[model samples]
Target chain A: MPSDSSPPNRRGLITLAWLWVAAPLAYGVYELVHKATQLFTG
Target chain B: MSSPPVAPAGWSRWLVPPAALSVHLSIGQAYAWSVFKPPLEAALHLDGTQSALPFQLAIVMLGLSAAFGGTLVERNGPRWAMTVALVCFCAGFLLSALGAGTRQYWLIVLGYGFVGGIGLGIGYISPVSTLIKWFPDRPGMATGIAIMGFGGGALIASPWSAQMLASFGGDNDGIALAFLVHGLSYAVFMTLGVLLVRVPRTGDGGGTASGPSGPSDLEGVQVSARGAVRTPQFWCLWIVLCMNVTAGIGILEKAAPMITDFFADSSAPVSASAAAGFVALLSAANMAGRIGWSSTSDLIGRKNIYRLYLGVGALMYLLIALFGDASKPLFVLCALVILSFYGGGFATVPAYLKDLFGTYQVGAIHGRLLTAWSTAGVLGPLIVNWIADRQKEAGKHGSSLYGLSFGIMIGLLVVGFVANELVRPVHARHHVPAPREAADAQRQQPA
Candidate 1:
């Protein structure tokens, strides 16, 4: 078994995961923005 | 816990959640059913209920397929499960497109509800156990991140579908085109998950090792899926989940019209456009709550968080029933909080199951539990809509039309609150003996 320390690259992996999460979330936000613009402007 | 296949060096346990998110976000489009309802009704000459059949059937199938395919998912691993989900989900859309082009409503139901729902079921559970295994220290937060994608999927799809319907013209051809695009796009999107996902090995520092060494490991009795179903604990959770979902869906399924009706007589009356905006806000609340509230469970403990979801959720409903139309902001606040609890209830349940059943077959048990969601899907809308329709016929207007339904929702939440209180740890007899138990026993023996 490996030692009981945290994984060496744990931070990097978490950063990558955040990137993955951010992509779709950005798209969702964009959609929401568009809808909000329409709701207010129109 | 059964050991996962060894992951290679440089593989991050964090990658698994994104993989799970990919599948969830795609299948979560099921919540955007209302986007297609108007166009389907126009083209098919159907009533409101008729147009709703495809989505309703899809939910039913989601629960059924999850329950039935859960064990297979556990055995075959996430890649196999995601691949099956991708095929069924994409194919369902394609078939629905074909059905729309041919003007066969039954075909749409069959494709989206039956076949696609199978995909939803399998795909929904596919990554759950894997995630719980990967993030043993923070199961609630881990599952929350992925399932939140499911809640947010409709946010993307609703606008996208509305645009497609507008561009294509709201006829049979337009609906078919929209369906085709959804299938093709999602198939491409879901492939990312299948490729990125990997199971961690036991004691590989991905959070599974917890006996004497790891301080963060979950200490609990493990129960198999079959054993879990027979337990009173499982049934109590089932009722809790069902009631929670039923209450939320009662408002969610009718968000737009219900709000319009509620404020129709007010000085600043709600317009159709404003109602659409209200739906969007509810979706935002639903999506945000999935991640926010479920992540909170990791801090507060799953049982304590559920008390908030069921207990406070009932109070929210009561507020809405009593003071809804009197003040619009209060009504919106109550509804938003209620919706959030609904989303939290969904995102928290997998971790709750992990706490009770162990990671060995948590995905399968979660699959069985989702039948509660299916039951709620039917019951929630039926109770709310049936009462609303009868009130309309009687010429009742505004909040009065929904007062009775909200009252019923309050009752359901109370039942769920009781069920949540009744939940206890699984019995030792139901727990599967850990493989390491025997090895540890042997090692401890004196010569």
Candidate 2:
């Protein structure tokens, strides 16, 4: 966990905060893996 | 307890509600996606289970994004948060449109699941803590007003999406066009929230509780986001929400297919339009659950309302399992009530957290706690879909496949019921003293 007391690196922290953008994107990618594989097999 | 500190100068508190309304309305569209399910499945020649992917992914993303974004929303305030939500939500839709148009299923998942999910999470928490700050006196009503927007989003989105699809026609081109429109429309709609929201002045944060309008003003207490997570009550309530949501979703995800399947071999099989009506009815129940049952939580207390959700919800599943297709009205009525409780479960939980934890960082904590919801989102659909799949392979037909699914839901709810009963007040060790209290304690300690 990032310490609460550190000086707020506004840009860096904002980037980190929004990095959760990856989670859903990653999950979406993960969920469709089988279909992608099926495309090749077919 | 002392009255919350007064607001700082020049902050416009009232603007917050509209900001909340914007996000809730847009994210709420998730409830209405089923309106488009049939045409998409037919157009794409996908299986019933495959058709459910986009909606399921959207929901899972909703919980995940919300859980992850909870704290950032607190630090950045509603404006920044709302902006993030708008961008992601719109982008998600656009991506999904591209995916649909080209027939690449992965794109739909990318657009809606990852992109749109972030929008759901950020939009969800954007106004939560700020609203609490604005209406310290009436946390439930404040949160309810905003959360209700989410519940009602589907009510608006369902008819609107249906009409759009109807006009556009059900080909891949049409569906993709509809998604593009949804993305653009939501972007426009959510702009209202971004422009209108303002944090309350720091000194003004006290005493505006809204609810059943009688003696139990305590219905909407405020708990800070951080303090809430430290308490066992938060986790216990988290279990209650996950269980309640899972139960309702299990039925909801399969409502149309289940109904049609149930009546297929029977004398009074459901027709196409009536099945459409069934989906609409479930939407109504889902919307009503957010407003009706959540508002009711003010009078009954959070625990008691959850008790109703879990206990009554379990019985509703049982009725469906034992009775089979005996009475359509009974099934519909029970399903509606259960869905309402599910919606209520979502709308009222923030208020319940307020009552237990106090509003210091309630929004952030609420966001964190939403991980439970994310977990339930996946678990709920997986349980329902997986069980149904196995049942189909076993040659189970119609409502019989649902029996095992509903039975599993019942067991889950039972465990949730126990968890609710176990919730108790926090001990002193977990309590972080307010700034004033900490200052006073320091003065009294030996030098």
Candidate 3:
């Protein structure tokens, strides 16, 4: 297998990936909250 | 065999699951199709069934494209597969917007169903084998995270789409705008997966042990997708998946209405809004089950976990059939457990495939297995809806309408349980031989 010669910081990349996952999930939560407000308050 | 590109230094295997989640979450929006149904029917002057064609065809295409494109995905690696998924998925939305703007239902079906569905299948599988390679120690948990995103996609999309429709008006123009936004936003969202994905440097040829967690016993044989189909183990699993999905989907496809019907005669009948709440709860159970139960599988063993899913799932159905209307709490508890099993079944199967077939072409094998899902997608709903319709015609009401369907589901789960019991490790004849050392050395050298 071709190995990476210049591997960057592993922790940074993993953190960045977690941010990507969190972005949508946060948006999803936001939407859910918005819907709940509409259902209860509107 | 040529080796896959090694991850550059600092590439934590942990980064891969999030990459997989990005793609799976975006494609999981397919589950929110119900939110679009009423609006599409009203705007297009179509019936409920007509409006459902896009969702139905998308599922069929998801299975077919996954099966046919599985090898392409495996050969090219996840980056290539995710790129194809991003393009097809986004483009399908763009085209659907055009179709809606022009009031052409066929175009909606063609774009969303055929094109987007291909994206769904490819996107769904793109991350599976990669995650397994990255987290060989916890295959079930790794896949569960990504597949859990798929189960939760609807939770995000349903309300978002509903709000968009509310704001934009439920006309063709509004629908087009929504489609356009969905296409563009998801393109940007799924790009994260395409950019972040990497195949393990160890390569997928079943040579190097993925991690310390990988099962030594499973190191025995690696079956090609072609060879796998010829084995009894594959067909047995196919039946197992189909029956499990069929049983869950039968109830899920009609959750809101079925619940209301079950309690129509109660002192405080289930209202439409309340029924919608019930659907949302089921979605939560479904999402939770994917991660929770699949993670549980890693500790208990895949075969054992399935015994619970298939066995307990049947018992849950029987509970509902016998005493569903007598108490609301009992009915809700049984339904929730059943939905969880449905989600668990989906989340755990890739790892199960890894167990039986090895990681060599497990993605492709998984894609082939999804054909069972497409089959169940049709079969489950058909059995429930057809039977319910007949019961109504025969003057049956309330829980009686679904009694036969629930009994049938129990029977199906029992069959699936038996099939799960029959699974064993693949034979050595099906294993792919390890790559020659000379070939590996040559590939490692500069061209």
**What lDDT is obtained when candidate 2 is compared to the true structure?**
0.72
| lDDT accuracy of residue B19 in candidate 3 | 81
- What is the model-wide C-alpha lDDT for candidate 1? 0.84
lDDT of 2 by residue, B1-447 (tens): 112222334334444565687678778787667777898788888887877787777777777777767767765666778888999989999998998899887898788877887888888887887776666555666787788778667666766788899999999999999999999988887877776666643234442221111111122333455666767888898898889889988888778788888778888887665665676667667766776776777777878988999999999889988875787778788888888888888888887776676665567778888888778877888998998999999999888878888899999999999999998866656655444533443456479
DockQ computed for model 1 against the true two-chain complex using alpha carbons: 0.34
How big is the positional error of residue B292 in model 1, measured in Å on the Cα after superposition?
Answer: 0.4
Residues B1-447 of candidate 3: C-alpha lDDT, one tens digit per residue: 223334554466666788888898899999888888998999999998899898888888899989998887777778888898999999999999999999998999999999999999899888887787777778899899999999878877887889889998889999999999999999988888887777654443222433211222234567788889988899999999999999999989999899999999998677776676677677778888999999999999999998999999999999999999998889989998999999999999999998898877888999999999989988999999999999999999999999999989999999999999999888888887644542454457578
Model 3 steric clash total: 5
RMSD of each: 4.0, 11.8, 4.5
For residues B1-447, what per-residue lDDT tens digits would candidate 1 score against the true structure?
222234566567767788898899899999888899999999989899888888878888888989988888887778888999999999999999999999999999999988998899899998988888778777888899889989878877877889889999889999999999999999988987887777765454344432211111335677778999999999999999999999989999899899888889999888777777777778888888898999999999989998998899989988888888898889989989999999999999999998887777788899999999988988999999999999989999888999999889989989998998999988888877655643454456477
What's the lDDT for all of these models?
Answer: 0.84, 0.72, 0.83
Ranking by DockQ: 1, 3, 2
TM-score of 2: 0.76
Relative to the true structure, candidate 1 has a C-alpha RMSD (angstroms) of: 4.0
Model 1 chain A poorest ten-residue lDDT run: A33-42
Question: Which pairs clash in the backbone of model 1?
Answer: none
